[model samples]
Target chain A: MAGVRILVGTAKGGFILRGDERREHFTVEGPLFGGWEVFHLAASPVDPERLYASQAGGWFGQIVQRSDDGGRSWNPVDNAFVYDGEVGDHLFYDGTPQPWTFQKVWHLAPSLTDADVVYAGVEDAALFRSDDAGASWGELTGLRQHPSGTQWQPGAGGLCLHTIVQDPTDPGRLTVAISAAGVFVTEDGGASFDPANRGLQSGEIPSEQAEVGHCVHKLAQHPSRPQTLFMQKHWDVMRSDDGGGQWTEISGDLPTDFGFAIDVHAHEPETVYVVPILSDSEHYPPDGALRVYRSRTGGGEWEPLTRGLPQEHCYVNVLRDAMAVDTMDECGVYVGTTGGTVFASRDGGDNWEAVVDHLPRILSVEVQTLP
Target chain B: MIRVTLPAHLRTLARTGREVVVEAAGDPPTIRTVLDALEGAYPVLRGTIRDHTTRQRRAFVRFYACGEDLSQLPPDTPLPDEVVTGREPFAVVGAMAGG
Candidate 1:
């Protein structure tokens, strides 16, 4: 078996895309997390056998599930990351006696060097770290217990860390993006984190409501230059060179400022992809054009990649996890939309082809080379 | 008496065009009662809107009316009297997709 595989997380469950170097095919072996919407799907950086999925709310509430054997079977990690007093000495900062809302797990990252050290960013502005490969987790005391956490108003999705970017070179270095909460980074594991939204814009609130944190939609990191980061903000696509210390708007020439997902090439950090949508009115694209923008010089300039896409009125929203870039030679760039359509670009967004459609609202898209 | 609108797909499945009329016994109608009335009139919609066990709305369906996310509103909650009076229509939007 080739070490290439693709996992598409949708409102229904997750579908594994299996195929060879010459031709790839998709099989819907899912509804993996019961009837919940799986928004985040991640593969174990240390072990290919392990897979993790964070399901968005539906019938089963928000939940996370683990699979030890590809996508064939799955079991919920009962103690995935409970914050109640019953689980060890861990506790929330507010000390509120009420239980957590069981918020959605928006993003998951298997540790870069430590096999068992997994990180999860969840709704309600919570951050958790697991030293046991997600079997159990502890809240990041600094971010979770920050004085500001309680007052942080929840975005439409809630005050959540939707993206987690870890420095592959330095295990201690990490960055997290929270919707409406801006961006935060840690240099020493997670003992502490500082607001990194120096030049980033955090939309306008009444002066009384304004503070740190920006309304960050999505973010991507350069594999070679960790300090260089790309982000899709609430109303703009911007980039930070000094590690979020400052930002520059790169979305000047796009169709619209509103978009959910952003991806960087595995080999070419400068190359990135984004699915543009109309700002959050009805949360669909303007004029229903199904197009994605590609940037080759780290958002220096972007061009619309619209080969093989629907030209008529198409009002589909693509979630952040729904678009990704694989490491194949031609580099497979895939994006799933709320219309239940999954499109793939084999020539690195230069050309496109429809892989599947009419399945379910897609939540996340992950690609791996199967062995 | 609250008014609930169904997307074109479910309406097609129910053999209706678009938007089916449903009746509720309470003041402020809820997702459950409206869905119950819809299912009662069209048995074909029984297991489609929500599961029999959980009664939770399917992932693809969104419940909106009077600026509220009826999805989380308790199934038994009173849907606003306006909706019950047929003066206002609660929209059940179908999430769109592409790209």
Candidate 2:
């Protein structure tokens, strides 16, 4: 009885898509938290039953909720999930005001090996590490206080850490991507970080890009190959070997380099996929065409997989977490759009089908394979 | 009058079988009145559709009248004739999804 659960968060609230893998019949659980924007959705890798979500509003502060029974019911943590120090008071300096109040938790990832080790990325481009699940969180003082933290400009949403990639092979070796901070890696967990965007073009051109501080939209690490990485940068989809120490552009035949979500095959390192859209002024799909392109050889060549989708005039903007690859036997590929549509590709982006439409502005898509 | 079909979740709450008949003169009228009448008859469905105090539709729950999204349509907006004539049932569905 394998159940595939999709955690969908939007500006209003969140819901759960419960589908039996064998039957393919699906049902949604609840609106969950009403009137709150759920941006980050995560399930504990160690315990599939435990689910976590980060909620925020235009004015309300950020909060994290957890579900013990496969997201059927949820409750907020006893103490609010946040950094150790207060929002606007720094003990080091005489009241310098510690930037923002951790506005949004864009990415929530539990440690692949440690059940209690969970990491959260938030506004002001801060990284918080929790060793005891959501019970207590401490700021990664090293990364938060790095000299480069000051220049890490956020994307349209403000400076925030949107993606966190932990090495399954080496639990201590981890990489995180900030919108404008490019990519940073820590060999000894979250103790310290160094800019790993050596060969990456920071921005549009080689000379113009920051080299290390490029505006990185998202990052995808092959589940098996810890050294190989794929990123949707401000300009292109890039590839990096040797654990993000350097990068090279791989967006050869794609319609445009601008996109949000990039997913690497869980078991196959060479196979990766990304949803492309027009960059700069042409921010939607190419000529208003909505298609997900797959590169069999690590973003070398691209092929548009649009079967069972709109052929013409599909101007959709897929968010960073909206497109995900199911790590199952069928290797399902799913992508949700800002237009409130979710498409599923069971054959790993070879074909596509619209499973649900007109729900709301889909902010994030997460696939959790049940045991 | 438009015939309304409640999903299993709502049907269990409404204690009805297949379809629930709502009385309306013209095209099912608007989502507001349809919900008002539905809840008026089945008080349990009142809080489920809209908040008890504000009477606002619950987030992620929308109305579908004749294959059209009636989520943003004002409560007073009139429904289609097919829905009013019982040819089509106005569905108050909870948008099922999670990510």
Question: Top model by TM-score, which number?
Answer: 2
Give the Å error, residue B36, model 1: 33
Candidate 2 per-residue lDDT, tens place, A1-371, comes to 48688888877778788778742667876576666788878888898888888876543245677778878777655224345444432221222334544456888898888777788887767788788778766778666666666545556766778889999898888798887667889888878888888767653434554644577889998777889989998788899888887789999988888888899876677888888888755667887778888888888798898787777888778889887777788788888888877788777877777767776788899888776
Quality of candidate 2 docking, DockQ = 0.02
Interface RMSD of each: 10.3, 11.0
Model 1 over residues A209-254: C-alpha lDDT tens digits?
A: 2445467888898679898999987778889888877778888678
Task: Identify the candidate with maximal DockQ.
Answer: 1
Give candidate 2 regions above 4 Å deviation.
A78-101, A203-211, B1-99
Q: After superposition, how far is residue A348 of candidate 1 from its true place, in Å?
A: 0.5
TM-scores of the candidates are 0.73, 0.74
DockQ of each: 0.05, 0.02
TM-score, model 2 to reference: 0.74
A204, model 2: CA deviation in Å? 5.7
